[model samples]
Each structure stands twice: as structure tokens, then as C-alpha cells.
Target: MDDIDQQLLLLLTRDGRASAADLARELSVSRGTVQNRIDKLKREGVIEKFTVELGRGEREHQISAFALIRGNADDDRRILASLRRIKEITQVSTISGTFDLVVELRCSSLARLDEVLDSVRSLPDVADTQSHIRLRTWRS
Candidate 1:
């Protein structure tokens, strides 16, 4: 990706719904060029997927937390599969050090979060887990 491509990604990250014409205008490039670059980015896997960033009001009603999971390396695949089945688990990543995996969960209520946590704890391979609820967040 070149400078223009990088700039396009920044703009898209701020607003994924930006139109080709809008991006062209901001980047001072032709609409076709913007479209071509976006297509190339997608083909190259630089653009994995477009997603929505919830507004403050919407986020205010949701609870976010992180789960530090410890498990046997041999059961990584099974553990990941179980996590994938839980709709509240928005993100999961294998990590180093004390924790084998980190999971991000967002739920509408504390009760829902508790239920999700229970489900995660029930996984046979999950030996232990430490959870932290996010009290506040700041984003750029």
C-alpha cells in the first residue's frame, strides 16, 4: 500500500460508509482511482471487513469486558471453536505469557455478561479465566 492507499484506509476507518465520490473529493483523486484502490485493497486482504463503530449513546448501554483465558495448547482449536459460537464474544486472540488467549465481550446487561462468562467457564479445556469489566473507554 502506498501513501494514497494508507490515507484512504484512514478515512474509511473514520467512516466506512464514505462514498467513492466523497473519498475522491477528500483525497483529491478521481472517483475511479478511489474505487480501484479500494478494490485492490480488498483483493490484497488489507481491508478485511467493513464494520460499524457504535455511537456514544449506543455504547453507553452496553457493557464491555475482557477475559484472559488459560488452557492447554492442544485444546486451542476446540477452545476457539467454543468461543466462536458465543455471539457476545466480539474478539478473540491467542497471546503469550500467563494467558493463552484473550477475549473481548460486549453485552447489553450485567446479567447477560454473567451468562456469557458462565458459558466460557464451562468449556472443558478452559482451565482458568480472569475477567475485567471496562468502566470507561477513550478512542481516538
Candidate 2:
């Protein structure tokens, strides 16, 4: 919430596995101070959770796409719940525009992606969908 906390978060974002001692050394503070700050950040919900970033080798073979969905209002909950069960669908968000929901998908092959898209299309109340395959990712 303060300058020190901001700096600590920035460092953690770069390397979530950094030790308290390492952080303390970089921040010119005691190890306990770093630990306490990290604990406080978690308690206050500023640090939601730690996660891993896959290496290029692990991701290069994967195909990714975004599917924009338009569905009936009454079936929104059902449609969303169904989409959540698909392993390839990583993220979904409700949007205010032409599309009612935007779903992010990742699969090992184009055939798998098509299968997932077909599954989505068959879901009840899903009136229409437009998919855009990601050619390349320049940045996160």
C-alpha cells in the first residue's frame, strides 16, 4: 500500500519464488521485515496468490483463441457453467457490447481447438459465437 510495499510487489511479480532473505537484502531491510510485509500483503488481499509462468518450450506447441459469445439472458448462468467445465477454456469474462461473454481457450492442436469450439456451439442458449485464433503473442 506504500512505496516499500509497491517495490516488494514489483520484485515478487518478477520472481514469485524469491526468498524473504533475498527480498530483504534487495530492499535493504531485515528478513523478518520482508516476511511481515509479505504476510500483510496476503492478509489484506493485495497479493491474491502466487503462480507459475510456463517457459516458451512448454507453450510454443499450444494454440490459443478467443471466442466471443452471444447468448440469451435467461440462460447466461447455465451457459457460463457449461463453459467452465471445458478444460481448454481458461478464462471467461462478461462484457458490455456486441458480445455477451469472451472466452479464452488453449489447446494442443487445431483439431482440439475445433472440438472445443464445437462443444461451445452446442451448449444451450448460445445463439452465436465468433472465434479469433491468436497468430502470435507479442506480450502478456
Candidate 3:
């Protein structure tokens, strides 16, 4: 990771789909040089994968919330597995500090959130849960 590599990474991070010729022009290098550097970056795992950012508003997206879930250590796997099976649950994390599990969910309405909470409350392992709705997101 030299200065050139760092610059290339910065450019690629902004747009992974950048063409070799475009990158070469931006970096003031030949196409072949850009290709080789990109190859090296990929080989070294500097760029793991590429993904697209979806427009949530136009999609079947719903209200999203973050939940702090407290549960017993023994039920960690089951609780996480259950969360994974739920389509609305997009992200789940075993967190430190106050929360055992941090869960992110997308729901159509408050009623849907209530339903989801009911299921979570029914889980014997879940001792408590605190949820907060997200008002807006400037960036993903």
C-alpha cells in the first residue's frame, strides 16, 4: 500500500465500476498499469467485493428501526438464527457495552413493528428490548 495504491483505492471506493481507461486517465497512468494495479489490489484483498446502493424510497421499503436486545448467552445462536430468517431484519450484531444484540428491522408500519416485537418478547431468552425508529437517513 504505497501512495499510488492509496489513491487508486480512494478512487475505486467511490466507484468500483470505474473502467481501466478511466482510472488510468485519472491516475495519469497507462491502461495496462491501471489494470495491473487493480489486479494486485484484488489479489491482496484490498477490494473484497462490489455492491449497488438501492433506492429504498422507490422500493418496497418500510420504516426502519434499531433495536437493542438483551438475551442469555446460551440463546445467542437461536436468537440470531431467528432474526436471520425474518425478511425485515436486515442487520444483526453481537454488540458490546449495553446491548447483547443490535438488530435493524424494516417494517411497513407501527402495527408491523408491534408484531415483530411480540415475537421477540415471546422468546424466552430475550430478557429485554429497546427500539428506536429511524426518522431519516442521509447516507447508507
Candidate 4:
């Protein structure tokens, strides 16, 4: 991507719902140019998808944590599928470290978080799990 494409992505990253006209104004290009660039970005897979960051009011009530997990290698696939079924577990990533996976959790309450943790631990494939409750989030 060129400088304009890079700049266009930054604008979209800041606000996914930004209009073509607004993006064009920000990038000092025509609306058609902005639309075409967005299309290209999507086609080339530079921008996979757009998502939302829960607002402060809702986020304040959200219990977020990262669970570092160790599990049997043979059960990795099943474990991931199970984790995906639990709504509170938003992200599950396999990483190279002492832990086999890192799971991100966002729950409605402490009780809910506890329940989710227990459910994760009970999975036969899950050998062990260490959780760290998030105290604050300065950046995404």
C-alpha cells in the first residue's frame, strides 16, 4: 500500500462508520477515491473486518481477564472449539511459551467470570489455567 492507502486505513481504524465523503475530506481526495480505496483494501485483505470497542459505561461493568492455559497437545482442537462456545471467552490464541494458549474473557460480573473460569478448568483437555484479572486498560 502507498501513503494514501496507509492514511486511509488510519482514518477507518479510528471510525469504522466514517462516511466516504468524510474520509475524502480528511484525506483531501474525492468521495469516489475514498470508496475505491476502501474497496481495494478489502479486496487485498489489508482490512479484514471492523469491530466495536464497548463504550466506557458498559466497559466499566465488564470483567476482563486473560487466562494462560496449559493443555494436552492432542486435545488442542477440541479445547479451542469448546472455548469458542463460551460467549464470555472472546479470544483464544495459541502462543509459544510456558502456556499453550491465552484466552481473553469479558464477563458481566465477578460471579460470571468465576463460573466461566470453572467451566474452562473442567474441560478434560485443559491441564491447568492461571488467570489475571485486568485492573485497567490504557490502550486497546
Candidate 5:
């Protein structure tokens, strides 16, 4: 990416909701140019998704946990699917290294977290899992 592309990305990363026209003005480029650059970014998968940063109060007050899961390929999909069904599980990624899957869950309370964990641990494919409760969150 060139300087202009980098600039556009930086601006958009800070405020995904910014209008193309606004970006154009800020970047000293045409609206169409801004739009094209954004389109290119999206096509390249550089721009993941437009998201709103929700405050703790705005969202369910919950503890966040990351888990390293182990399971067979088919079991991995099933486990992830089941985890996704839980409203509290906001992020799940199939990763490399010692862990097979990395999961992030947001629970409303300690009881809710235990409930989620119980559900996950009970899965037949899950051999073992490690979890860490988030003490603080800096950003989305």
C-alpha cells in the first residue's frame, strides 16, 4: 500500500463510520477516489468489518474467557458450532500451535461463565481445555 492507501486505512480504522465524502476532504482526494480505495481494501480483506465499539454498560455485563480447545476435525466443527450457538461466545478461531481452537466468550456473570464452561467441557470431542478470565479489556 502507498502513502495514500495507508492514510486512508489509518483514517478508516479510527472511524469506520466516517463518510466517504468526509474522508475525501480529509485526505484531499475526491469522493470517488476514497470510495475506490475503500472498495479495494475490502476486496483485499484488509477491511474486515465495520463495527461499533460498545461500552461495558452498553453490553451485557459479563466475564470474558479464552479457551484452548482440542478435538478432531469433525469434532472441532461440531464443538465450534455448539459454542457459536451460545450467545455469550463472541469469538472462535481455529488456530495453529499447541491449541486447536481459541474461543472467546462473554458471560453476564460468574454463574453464566460456569454454565458455558460446563456446556463446553461436556462435549464428547473436547479432550481438554484451558481458560483464562479477562481482568481488563482495552479495546474491541
Candidate 6:
């Protein structure tokens, strides 16, 4: 992507609901240009999908944590499939380290988080998991 496209993505990241006209105004481009670029970004898979980012007050009731997972390389497909089925597993990333994956979990309550963790631990291929509960957030 070019500089303009990168800037457009930044603006959208801050507010996904911004109108085409507003985005054009900020980007100093025509509305049609903004819309066309957005379409191109989506078509090229640079933009996966758009969804709401909950406000801090709404997120305050939720519990979030990160899990560093170590598993058998051959069993990754099975382990990852199991993780993807759990709605609480928001994000997962493959990492080059002692851990094979880093998982992000968000649940409504501590009890629910405990249950989700238990379920994750019981997955057949998951050999080891280190969890860190987030106490507070200073940034998004």
C-alpha cells in the first residue's frame, strides 16, 4: 500500500464508522477516491472485516488474559482447531520461541475465564501453557 492508503487505514483504525465524506475530507481526497481505495483494500484482503471496538466502560466488566502455549508440532492443526472453537479465544499468533503460540482470551467473568482455561488445558495436544491475567490497561 502507498502512503495515502496507509493513512486511510490509520484513520479507519481510530474510527471504523467514519463516513466516506469525512474520510475524504481528512485525507484531502474525493469521496469516490476514498470509497474506491477501501474497496481495493478489501478485495486484496488487506482489510479483513470491520466491527465495533467496545468502549472502556463496556470492557471493564470483562476479564482478559494471554496464554503462551507449547504443543507437539505435528498436532498443531488439531490443537488450533480446538482453540478456534472456543469463542473466548479472541486472537492467536504463531511465535518463534519456547512457546508455539500466544493466545488472547476475553471472558465475561473470572469463573468463565477459569472454565475456558480448564478447557484449553484439557485439549489433547497442548503440552504446556503459561497464563498471565491482565490487571489493568493503560493503552489499547
Tell me, by lDDT, which candidate is best. 1
Tell me the spans in candidate 3 whose CA falls farther than 4 Å from its real position.
3-9, 16-21, 30-46, 59-61
Residue-level lDDT tens digits of model 6 in 1-140: 99999999999998999999999999999999999999999999999999987799888889999998999665588888999999999999988889999999999999999999999989888999999999887756
**Measured by TM-score, how close is model 1 to the native structure?**
0.92
What's the lDDT for candidate 1? 0.95
Give each model's clash number.
0, 0, 0, 0, 1, 0
Q: Write the per-residue lDDT of candidate 1 for residues 11-123, one digit (tens) a residue.
A: 99989999999999999999999999999999999999999988999989999999999996655999999999999999999899998999999999999999999999999
lDDT of 3 by residue, 57-131 (tens): 643467788889998765598888777777888789888876799988888888998888788767768888999
85: Cα error in model 3, Å: 0.9
Listed in order, each prediction's TM-score against the native is: 0.92, 0.86, 0.70, 0.90, 0.76, 0.93
Ranking the candidates on TM-score from highest down gives: 6, 1, 4, 2, 5, 3
TM-score for model 2?
0.86
Candidate 5 lDDT over residue span 68-112, tens digit each: 888855457778778778888888998888778988887878998
Tens-place lDDT per residue, model 4, 33-88, is 99998999999999999899889889998999999999977559989989999999
Q: Regarding TM-score, does 1 or 2 come out ahead?
A: 1
Cα lDDT for residue 49, candidate 5: 85
Worst 10 residues of 3 by lDDT: 52-61
Top-down lDDT ranking: 1, 6, 2, 4, 5, 3
Worst 10 residues of 1 by lDDT: 72-81
CA lDDT of each prediction against the hidden true structure:
0.95, 0.92, 0.82, 0.92, 0.85, 0.93
True-vs-predicted CA distance for residue 88, candidate 3, Å: 1.4
